[model samples]
Target: MKTEKEKMLAGEAYLATDPQLTADRRQAKKACQLINQGDYDDEAGRNAQLAALINFQGSFYVEPPLYVDYGYNILVGDNFYANHGLTILDGARVVMGKNVFIAPNVVISTAGHPLDKVRRAAGEEFVKPITLGDDVWLGAHVTLCPGVTIGNNVVVGAGSVVVHDLPDNSVCVGTPARPVKSLA
Candidate 1:
């Protein structure tokens, strides 16, 4: 039998209230709290906390008030910068390549509840991985939904909701984000 975490990672329906999942989320929350309380000048401390919280790699700057669920499922590459209020519901994996810039109030969620009200009410949820390639920029308030794969050098406009895979070197905007132009 698959563990709850295993099921979650596999994109299979799982119980969110499972003890292990709850503990993981609590640990992530504690790390976020510590980071949020630390001084802005204490870069090392903040980075350490973030490192303990997630699968962070290379160099990165994350302005706090950040939140995550199962931080271990997130992987960010070099030269990443995220402004305030960044939230990642990484029930499944979230991978980001080098030079990714995220503006304030941006959310990347990998967990999705079932459409069936009965199942949703029962706390059953599934996860899908989200990926962002190198040199990607997300404007303020942008929300990247589950299973989104944004290509390299792409720019997502502010307040946009990315619901589908975006092509490389494209500029996307508005709800259900559509490619407005190609940079290539």
Candidate 2:
């Protein structure tokens, strides 16, 4: 028998209302609140709170108004920078490689409910991890869906919704997010 956390991490359908999962979400929310409300000059306080929540490597800078479901599921590499209004529904792992940059109002969601009405009504949901390779940049209002892998040196345009894997060194845009320009 697997716990809700284990099921969620394994990409299996799980109930979000489980006690331990609820507690984890609460902790993440508290950390986000502390980081968001911290004084701009008090980088140490903000970083301290963020450090306690996420697994970040080397250096990172995240602007206020950031949100996450479970901070422990996120892993950010060196020189990661995210602007305001970044929301990560990290039901599973959200891995960002080195030099990743995210603009304002970006939503990276790893959790989704089943298409079946009964399952959705029962609060059954599954998660798929999202990964961003090194030197990736996501523009403002971009939405990265579950199971997406943005390749290295890729630049996603503003207001785009990425639903699939994007090749390296490309510029992508649109609803389903297809590469429009190849930098290679």
Tens digits of lDDT, candidate 2, 48-97:
88888899997998899899999999999999999999999999999999
Residue 174 in model 2: shift from native, Å?
0.4
How many angstroms is residue 109 displaced in model 1 relative to the true structure, after the best TM-score fit?
0.5
Off by over 4 Å in 1: none
Q: Rate the local accuracy (lDDT) of all candidates.
A: 0.94, 0.95
Among residues 3 or more apart in sequence or in different chains, the pairs in candidate 1 whose N, CA or C atoms overlap within 3 Å are: none
Error of 1 at 107 (Å): 0.6
lDDT score for residue 16 of model 1: 90
What's the residue-level lDDT of 37 in candidate 1? 87
**How far out, in Å, is residue 58 in model 1?**
1.0
Superposed on all Cα atoms, model 1 deviates from the true structure by an RMSD in Å of 0.7
